[model samples]
Target: MTPAPGGFTDETFAAFLKGRDEPSWLADRRRSAFGRFKATPLPTLRDEEWRRTDLRALKLDQFAPPAPAEPSEAARAALEPAYRGLDSLYGTGIALVDGHAARSPDPSKLGGAVFVDLASAVQEHGELLKDLLMTEAFRDDADAFAALHAACWTGGALLYVPKGVKVETPLFHLVGLSAEGGADLSHTLVVLEEGAEATLVQETIGLDRGKAPGLHVGGVELILRRGSRLRFVNIQNWDTSTWHLSRERAVVGPDAALQWTVGGLGSRLAKVNQEVALVGRGARAQVNGVMFPTGRQNLTYITRQDHVAPNTTSDLLYKGGLKDRSRLVWRGMIKVEPDAQHTDAYQKNDNLVLDADARADSIPGLEIEANEVRCTHGATAGPVDPEMVFYARSRGVDEATATRLIVEGFFANVYDRISVEPVREALALAVAQKLELGSAPTLASAEAAGV
Candidate 1:
C-alpha cells in the first residue's frame, strides 16, 4: 500500500484508520490515493487553472491535521444562533468541528437519506465509498488541490439522497476549520435519484486564534438523476489568514435540472472551481455566484459548461466586487461536442471594482463541434458606472453608500435566479453582510461612527 505524503506520513494514515475503525477496503483506497497523490505534483502558476494565482509562498508540507477541537462555553453559545433556522431548510443537520463530527444528526425524518462523516461512511458503506470516491465526480487533473484532497482527507460529510424522495428543508452541513497549523480535507457528495427533488446548503466557517496559517481543501459533488431537480447553495466564510481551495461539480441526467447559487466572502486567498455537465437530453442548469473581497485578499473563479447531448441548456452568471487592494479573476468555458446538435448555452461574468488598486479579469470562451448549436459567451470587467454613481449620490447617498448600492444592484440578477423566497432571502442577507464587512460600510457601523 502507498503511504500518505506531504507530512501525513505512513504512520499517520495507519493511525487514522485504527482510530476511526475504518474497513479494510476503505483503508486500501486511501493507501492507493496516496500513491496517486505522489504521482501528481502540486500545481504551480504554470498550470492553466492556476495561472492567475500565486503559490510560491504556500508550502503544503508546513501543515498537519489538527488534534480534535473542544469549543468553550462562549464558542458554543456563539454557534447556537446559527442553528436555529436550519430546521426550516434541512431534514438533517450535521455539524463538523475541526475535522470530526461534533454532534450526531438525526436522520429519522430523511427516509432514504444517509448523512454521516467520511470516516463513518467508509465503515458502513464500504462498497459505495469505493465506487464514488475520487471518480469522475471530481476532475483532479484540473487542479492539484483536488488531488491533495483525495489523498489527505482525514474526515468529511457525505449526504446520499435515495430515489423519488423529496427533501423539504435543505441539508445543512457545517464544517469548521480550527487553527493550530491545522489542515482540513472535507468532502461532500449529494446524489439525487430519478424523479427526486432536494435543496442542500453547505456552510464553511474558519475560526482559530493561532497565528499559524491553515489550509482547507474541500470537494462537493452533486448528481442529479433522470427527471430529478436539485437546488444547491454554498456559503464560504473562511478566516482571513487561511487558504481555501474548493471544487464543486454536478452531473445532470436526462430531463434533470440543477440550480447553483454561491457566495464567497472570507479568505486570505481562495480559488473555487464550479463545473456542470449536460450528459443527457433535455437537461437544464443555471449557475450563479457573488463574491466580495477586501484588503489584500485574492479570489479566483473557474467555471465550465460541458454539453454532450442534444437539446441541453445551461446559463452562468457571476458577479464580483473588489475593494482596497483585493483582486479577482474569472475564467469560464462552454464546450459543445459533435453529437450535441441543438445545444443552447450562455456564459457571463461581471465585475464591479470599487477602488483604483482593485483588479478583476474575465476570460469567457466557447468551443463548438456542431454547427446547429446556438452558443453565446461574454465577459466584462469595469468599475461602477460613473453616471449611476452620480445619480445615486444626487439622491442623498454618500460616495460609500452610492458604491454599495451599485454593487448590490450588480448582484441582483444572481439573486433572481433562485425560485424559493425564503432561501433567496437567506442568501441575500448573507451576501449583504459579507459586502458590508467587505467592500461596503454597514448601516450600523456607519451610524456608530457618525455618533
Candidate 2:
C-alpha cells in the first residue's frame, strides 16, 4: 500500500529494503514493523509519557530517509577534532558519516568478537542477528517512533563478544549526520555471551546545522548473558536544529553486571527512554548520566530499572546543568516485581540551573510489588548553591568562574562513579566545553591539587 501523502509510505519502505538487498527475514521484519508504525499514531501531548514534552513544532513529513553520502570536506574536518586524541583511548573504532560506515575497526583487534556494520553483520551472522535484532530487548511496537526506527534504520553497528573473552580496551563507535532535512535512523545491538566482559562507547553527532530541520531516530539494545559484565557509555551531541528520539534497553542474566553511562549535551529537542531489566538472580545494574543543555534546547530523559528476579540490585544517578533558556525533564522509575523479593533499587536525578531562564523538571518514582524489596527514589532541581558560590568567591574566584566550579563539582559525583578513566575524562572535557570553561580548572584537576 502507498504511504500517506508527504509521509513515508509502505512502498517507499519496501523499496528501501530492496535497495539494501537485505536478508529475507530482515525484509519481512521491516515490513511488519512498517505496518505497526502505520497502525500506531504519532504520539501527542495527551499521552502520559509525552505530556511534558511538546513535539507539535516538529514537521516529520519534511524529513526523508537518510542515504549513504560521501562525507563532505567540512563534515570530515569537523569530525576530526572529536577524535584528535582519542586514538589511544580506544582499541577499536568505527565511524559512520550520514548513516554510512566511514571507518571500520581492525579485524585483528576484534579477536573472536564480531564488530561490523549492521547491514554486513546481517548477512554474516544471520541466525544470531535474527534472534536478537528488533525482537529481544526493544520491541517494534514499543512506540510509534520505535516501530519507525525498526522499519527504516540504515547503517548501524553490531558488537558481539564470545563467551569467556574479556576486551581490555574500550570499543568506540561514532555515528554522525550531516545532511539537511534528512533522517538518521540507526540501531546498535550489543550481545555479550556468558562470562564475557567488555566496554563500549557510542557517540552520536550532528555535524551540520542544516538550513532545514533534521530528524534522528535511533535504538540501542544490549544483552548480557549469564555471568557476563558490560560497561556501556552513550554520548549524544546533535546539532541544535535536529529533533532526536531514541530508546535503549538492556537485559541482564544470572550473575551478570551492567554499568551504563550517558552524556547528553546537544540537540534542539530530545526525548530518550532508557531501561535496564535484571531478569536473573544476582544480577546488578548501575546507571550514571550527565547532561548539559544550553541555548533554547529542550531535553527529556526517561529511565527505568526493573527487578524481575530475586536478589537483583539496581542503582541509578543522573545529574544535569541547564543554561540559557534550556529546559530538562528527567523521569526515573524503579520497579520490583512480586518474585523479586530480595531486590534492591535506588534512583535519583539532580539538576543545576545555570541561568534564571533555564528550567528543569525532575521526577523519580518507584513501583514495588515485593514487600521485602528495598526501593527508594529522590529528585532535586535548583540553582547552584549560593553558599558554595560565596565561598568560592571569597577565595578570589569570579562569579561566573565560581558557578562553573560549582557546576563541575555537581557533576563530579557521577564522573567519579564511572569506572573508565578515559570515558570520564572525555565526558569532563565535553562538559567543560559545553559550560564554556575551556581554561578553568576541572574538578579532577582541582582535587588532584588538593583544592
lDDT against the true structure, each candidate: 0.74, 0.82
Tens digits of lDDT, candidate 1, 385-427: 9999799888899987887777767888887887755555665
Q: Write one digit per residue (lDDT tens) for candidate 2, span 370-441.
A: 899788888898988889888989999999889778878888999999997777876777777778832222
Model 1 ranges off by over 4 Å: 1-6, 66-79, 85-91, 140-143, 208-210, 439-451
* Model 1 deviation from the true structure expressed as Cα RMSD, one decimal place: 4.3
For each of the candidates, the C-alpha root-mean-square deviation to the true structure, in angstroms, is 4.3, 3.9
- Candidate 1 yields a Cα-based lDDT of 0.74
Model 2 misplacement above 4 A: 1-5, 68-85, 437-451
Residue 229 C-alpha lDDT in model 1: 91
Residue 433 local lDDT, model 2: 71
